[model samples]
Target: MTKKIVVLGVSGSGKSLIGKNIAEKLGYRFFDGDDFHSTANVEKMSQGIPLTDDDRKDWLAALNKLLIDNPTAVIACSGLKPEYRAMLRQGLDDVAMVYLKGSIDTIWERHQKRDDHYFKGRGMLESQFATLIEPTEEEAFVIDIAQDADAVLNQALSLLSES
Candidate 1:
């Protein structure tokens, strides 16, 4: 069985909501990658500063450790760059990546509706899209996010069940 599932997407793509639902369905622990960020990283994002690879090094390492420690977990993370994704899967074979895909315009509208999050604004979304390398079909279970949330969750569960 796939023990580690990482939900990958930019902000406003519903990684957290989808990941949490998936975890609940599978009886696995759920983790929001944003919560593991250092105080400095959160501060930078709150100030509208995009995190560089250097800024993410430690954060990614910590997430990788979380995967290593947990036998069954669903983590919502912005696995944007290829290297970042590769690092996330290092030494792990029973891992599954679910990439929630949507257009910038589609996600931008969602981003606008959110108010309780620190990672807000169109600029931040643009920065994430710019950095995103988009995992290939071979690399992840890709799910379209343009549909309703229930449909998206069902599709994810179906795909994961097959794996």
Candidate 2:
């Protein structure tokens, strides 16, 4: 069966990059969840304001639609909170979540180097870390982001194989 994968993490955890690579390897379609966000959501995030659950309702619904539309696909999204992850999983039978786990410092360092992005600097990173509810082993195929991209991808692929 074709796998439906969600590459999930905080900003700067390399979800977009990693998800695209995984999709390419697996011959599945790839989507960046940021592209699904409404302009208002982007504006709020661009101003370094953290999104409330209400703000994410439409966005999450849109992502859910994407998941439904493409059964064999890899999507990059910040499924930070448990509720968020649960929402994503709703109505899906064979979805595999790849949580890109990373420390605040590591994420912040990467965020600083990013020249073009909606999510801003340290404050936004801190908010994301605070909001995140780390997924358990049963909930996701967790991969540490301290490793290089290729290593992370290999580990994720290995875990997905077992799952």
Candidate 3:
């Protein structure tokens, strides 16, 4: 079994929910990467600001350390860029990535129903999509999220088993 897993997607793509489910099913610790963000980052996002690479440098390092500290855990993170994913994987060879894939319209609809999140607005979502560098098949299990969340979770679990 892969001991370390990161659920990757833009906001509103269900990374947190799916990551939690994966951790529960695997009997592993769950960490929401959002909780590890700096106060400044959170503040910026609350104001509808898109974070740059430099803004994420320290955040990624902290998440990498979290992975190092907890050998068996699942994390929810945006990981929009390849370099960001690389940073998250630093010093971790057994890490697995599960990307929740969905169309903007689909995710936007879902985002509308969500509540109390720092990240908001269609523009923010668009910025996230613009920043996204999707992982290759070899790099992550890509689960289509146009289906129901339950189906998406089932598919992710099934893929993990196969891999």
TM-score of each: 0.98, 0.97, 0.97
Tens digit of lDDT per residue, candidate 1, span 70-107? 98999999999989998898888888999999999999
> Cα RMSDs of all predictions?
0.7, 1.0, 0.8
Compared with the true structure, the alpha-carbon lDDT of candidate 1 equals 0.93
Residue 14, candidate 2: Cα error in Å is 0.8
> What are the runs in model 3 whose C-alpha is more than 4 Å off?
none
What digit string (tens of lDDT, one per residue) describes model 3 on residues 2-80?
A: 8899999999999999999989999999999999999999999999899999999999999999899996989999999
Model 2 segments beyond 4 Å from truth? none
Q: Whole-model Cα lDDT per candidate?
A: 0.93, 0.90, 0.92
Task: Show pairs that collide, candidate 1.
Answer: none
Show how many residue pairs clash in every candidate, following the order shown.
Answer: 0, 0, 0
- Best by the lDDT measure: 1
- Model 1 stretches with alpha carbons more than 4 Å out: none
